[model samples]
Target: MNESAATITKPTPLLIELRGVTKIYGSGAAAMSALRGIDLHIDQGDFVAIMGPSGSGKSTCMNILGCLDTPTDGDFFFEGVEVGRMNRDKRALLRRHYLGFVFQGYNLLNRTSALENVELPLIYRGVPRAARRARAQAALAAVGLAGWENHTPGELSGGQQQRVAIARAIVTEPRVLLADEPTGNLDTARSREVMELITTFNREHDLTVLMVTHEPEMAAYAKRQVHFLDGLIVPGPNQGGDA
Candidate 1:
């Protein structure tokens, strides 16, 4: 099999889809467009990395995909549901129900124990206390953090903190995992560990992962890579067309 074939097999029915997604800031001639009519789809179990230089609009795309920001004009469908049309409360509900996020900084609360951090989402969803604790512990154990649950972020190393973050993000068994520069702050060894953890979850749990990164090495871990240039989607040197 070819190298590309060794990576992503083929596109199935997409869990994340975007059409004519545009984000414009400002007005008139001074109007700046962050994303310009981008069309993309990512199937279930696909691990995609979005790459671009600074100001290339990849970050904006990440925000839109994560439901943290709405597009200025366009249609976005998540798991066949029209998410772009939902109100703020509904959007929050959808995010809580179907999306998980990890970031460069591993934003675990300083005051909360790792276990509590993982349980926060379940609490927000009104999960019963006992069930929430059980699931949170299970998620942490999945990430190889079984004995570290009582530690706080300050007590863990960079890699450990990120594992806790990943544990928190996946505890809900979200439909999609959105990671923005997940290893930007880690050392090479730590970054590789984090990427491997993510890849394992993608392969074993069938989680759809969309990650944003500028590093080619990091992007290589994904099943497909999409490049952006000047606020538009451009074909990356390694991308296998619109698969």
Candidate 2:
């Protein structure tokens, strides 16, 4: 047998990984380093809450994980494939097929019905209208908005609007859900409600969830917490991603 064939290596089992990942914006003296030699790992079905003060690079890390931005140095692996090297079009397909996102701001159209809003991702994938409607309706129902499908964003309450956003995010059944301050715009009661629903999804679907939130109460809902500061992760609990 050949030496190369005898030394076969198994691919990493992690769903997401960042090794020596650094992101620098601009050039020369104008450059701002957002991530400083970060090493993190996320396993399948891991729910991680990324906490930090503003400008701590948590958002930058989130952007890189969501494929919205690229790292200036090091490697990002999704399913052991180096994502940092994938071109923009390939990244878009990865986002469409494997990732879902929810923002603090409910990015819904004011005039569009909740069902249509939930159907948007499916439309992007060229799903037929009937299938899109069925999936969207089921997604809305999963988020506790069964009868409110026809209501526009302007007609829904703040909590209801956020739920609609969640429905839209999960309608595609993505493997990783990237949530940026998902409950930031809601009241305390509503925030807890949203957290409960998120927790339920993480449990029931075994979803890999990465949520960025500064609120401790919200972070507590996650299985593990990762703290960031001054463009680096704090040592201790989050020294490793699964910690």
Candidate 3:
């Protein structure tokens, strides 16, 4: 066999990356820094937990990662594309196509059924009614809420509502799932159920996951945890303690 023929080269793109990231609110003396000169990387299919105390910039970082907010300084790359430099419309499009978000509040439509709420993203993307309905139903089933599709949030328990939210997030088949305190509103048993579902989705679908959690038990579900304090990453073993 020829040496040239045997040679193989391929590079895996990082699903998310931040370099020298900084976030500042206001300006001058009144300005408050959220994230300061931070560098972080997450590859495809990796589960990362971002843990930090209140006002430690973890939320800011999650916003930037989810394309919900732009950094005041430095670069943010998503799947080899520079998201920080993209215009607002481009950023919006990027988020619509590549990102899914699950929040502590389980931002589902209060008046809508679980299936309809799960279909909202697809509806925004101009997916036809039939296709969106089918996909939404499938997503609901994936989250173990097959029979709850017709129920509204008010009719479900906290865990069920969160399950609907997860179904909505995954219905789009996004490349990255940004979960901000996803289990924050659930009880211990419910939290375990939610985390197990998330873990299964991450492993079976090969989805990249980035979660922000103040609870150590919640963060333990992730493969690796990165701690933040006073706007910077806390290096060493101390990083694993309570946020």
Candidate 4:
């Protein structure tokens, strides 16, 4: 195609898009609307942070973006595919292939070694044992936990556990990383360390990152910030600019 034609025909795919999304818990009088007509789009390779106080619908938005839950109304599109009405198994598959999750609590099996914990996703995907071990080892090393591969969660510090959790999240080489309060449990120093790792991954791998954080400093680590208030997105100067 010619330059003009190419420019006109080219399509920019969004990593995640929410069009008039509304999430409500319960029904009728008891219903609690967690999200109110959210319209958001995250482009590929963008690092966006969702910030809001508790009950502001940030977590609800994250859940919808992560495929953990569906919107009560409107649509959610991931990589140009509608996912709002996907079956549980399809949504699980979508998450496995396209998204990774990191959480504040650093969810890890207490008795499992770091390497084993990181290998869980690959195991679920039925990767070969040898490949799983190799990939898990590399992931752990990437997160600066090279020598801690054999250590269980109980044997690691809070920061170390969080590193392991991050290792696990990226082991599958997902296209997007959803981190909800990733640094919530860490001290200032540890939080910075974790953010540095996350930033490195985003830059080096061109990974799209969507994070939910209440701390302004944490949100500042992201390239853009989207604020939420009263179940709706709040317009701000940093809506899609440098946070």
Q: Which ten residues in a row have the lowest lDDT in candidate 1?
A: 1-10
Q: Order of all candidates by lDDT, from best down to worst? A: 1, 2, 4, 3
| Candidate 1 CA-lDDT value | 0.89
| Per-model TM against the reference | 0.93, 0.92, 0.92, 0.92
Query: Which has the higher lDDT value, candidate number 2 or candidate number 3?
Result: 2
**Model 1: runs farther than 4 Å from truth?**
1-11, 238-240
Worst 10 residues of 2 by lDDT: 1-10
Per-residue lDDT, model 3, residue 140, is 98
Tens digits of per-residue lDDT, candidate 2, 1-243, equal 122321333431478989999999999999999999888999877789999899999999999999999999999999899998788999999999889999999889889999999999999998999999999999999999999999999999999999999999888888888999999999999999888988887877767799999788899999889888888988535346444
Candidate 2 residue 181 C-alpha distance from true site, Å: 0.3
- Model 4: CA > 4 A from native: 1-12, 237-243
Best candidate per TM-score, number?
1
114-161 in candidate 4: lDDT tens per residue?
999999999988899999999999999999999899999999999999
Deviation in Å, model 4, residue 86 alpha carbon: 0.5
Question: lDDT of each structure?
Answer: 0.89, 0.88, 0.87, 0.88
Clashing pairs in 4: none
